[model samples]
Target: MSAAPLTYTPLDPSGFEELAAARPDVVIPIEQTPAWIGFERALGRTPLGIWAYRDAAGTLVATASFVHVTRRFRESVVVINGPVWFAERTPAAERLLMDTVREQFREHPAVDPLYVRMQVATPQAPATGPIEHGWYEREIVVDLTPGEAELLRSFRPNARNSIRRAQRNGVEVKHIPREEWKEVFATQLFPIMQETAARDGFQAFDSSYYETLLTVLGDHLRLLVAYRDGTALSWLITTEYRGYSVYYFAGSTLEARSTFAPYLLLWEAFRVLKAAGNTACGLTGIASENYPGLANVTTFKRNFSKNVVVVPTTYDIPLDPVRYTAVASILAARRKAPAAARAAARRATGLARRVGRGRGAVGASRHS
Candidate 1:
């Protein structure tokens, strides 16, 4: 018999969940989940979804969900960690899926997006296909299959020592229950997040964004906080699905640095997630050439595991090349502004210190 033809159809959250459930071996990204779609909706992003299936067998083979965003009258569709394939994925199929999505979006009356940007998030290695890869990144995956002793042995000496120190210092890691999520975020998580952002010179999402994530993802998401002497020192938010967990978001206090709470916090996360039946935990998006600003956090993550994986880079399908270029340039500048500003501030401070020292030297010479 001839093979069943591939068919494309509109997909809803329930349909996407069914496809995810059917594919056990594939690592379906947390960002591609139905809960994430709900979170995006809560954040006011319009959703666009599609699925590819076998016509004869009615089996889902692929799924992609995108958020339609408009800024300054320029529209864009963004797919983060998605356009996932459940079956054998060929370059041709990948091209076809993207082509179909582009056509659908173009035909839709409500949307006239300048481009569609898809950031590859999969267990597969980087592709050598027509999808011109950009924004390359490194991700570290910790194998939770090993015993605690073996796990500890895999880490860098500093990480191992820090974990031990935190333990000795009486740092306690707590898994916040669902009922306490609202209270926890309002009182603890959001405040710590703001402080981290201010110290690190990055923007933090609003409280509602996290609240929606915690509420919608429910059991799939775990918020683990490290406490020292009854004071919250560090926190990690991880999402679990199909025996895998993603180290999603985190924040640490200055006390966490001195107390080594972050190290113990991650170690505890590994134990808790492993005990919850997860085989691996992904310390998502480490520092890379494309994202050098993450160097500090990357140093911290490398302490735990060296099982680095190269994820496929993002690709853009420009519907209107001219407008896409214009808008892309604007967006890129907007993204870099904060980093540039921080660098400028540092330079200014250094110059001020040098001038002060020069004046002091002249004053010492006059006294002499």
Candidate 2:
């Protein structure tokens, strides 16, 4: 017998939850969830469409959520790992997903977008090696299927011993409830994030982002705090996606470094997520080679497993090449502005320091 026909139709969040409930293995980030799209819409983006692919038996096999991104009057329909499939990760299934979305974009004039950007978020590595295709191009995943001892056994001695030492020093990890998320953000997490960004030379978002995330994600958002002697030392922000938990954000106070609270905080998070039945805990994106801090973070992650995976780069399917290229170029240029400014500031400071030293030497000669 021939295979059943596959067809795509609009699906709501309820339908998505129903299907996802049946297929627990289809773990996708909360951002891809329909509720998240709704939150985005409430915050001003146009939600273009939502769809589900079903077999002839009328069972939903895959689901997708689409949102229209408009900047300076230019627009694009973002797929963002939509059409999440419950079927095996076969080429045909992936092909159908791409083909269906492309065909829809072609036939529908109302959904006209310069290009469709699909952010890949799968465990399976893409056929393409590495290119630019993600909000973050690389990430780390820790196996949580094994028991605590087995999981700890996989860690390098440094990470393992640090965690043990932190515990021995009376570091305690606790969950911060939603009501107190704002308080923790303002009082503890914010200052540490500022310190981290300054030391690492990265831009840090204000506490409002965490506030909105906590308000929207509700049960899916998990905040873990590492404390000692009544003082909060470090905190980690995580989200419970389909089958995995994502390590979204984290920071530690300067004093906490000596106690290694950050390492124990991670181990505590892994334990909680594993006990909650997640198959693995994704460390999310670490720095790439191009970034100076990548080495330190890469080594930190490798201490857990050498099995670090580089996910498929984000794919941009363009309908209007000229417009797409124009917009892409502008966005890329804007992204580089911050780094350029930092470099310029450093050069100016160095020049001023040299001039000060030269003047001081002449004044000393005059005194002699």
- Best lDDT goes to which candidate? 1
Q: What is the lDDT of residue 249 in candidate 1?
A: 89
Among these predictions, the greatest TM-score belongs to 1
Model 2, global lDDT: 0.74
Q: For candidate 1, lDDT tens digit of each residue in 80-114?
A: 78767776676655655556666767787888887
lDDT of 2 by residue, 8-77 (tens): 8876778777877877766666767876776676566787667787667776666667888775646777
Collision count of model 2: 3
lDDT of each: 0.79, 0.74
List residue ranges in candidate 1 displaced over 4 A. 1-6, 53-61, 120-136, 329-368
TM-score of 1: 0.82
Q: Weakest 10 consecutive residues, lDDT, candidate 1? A: 123-132
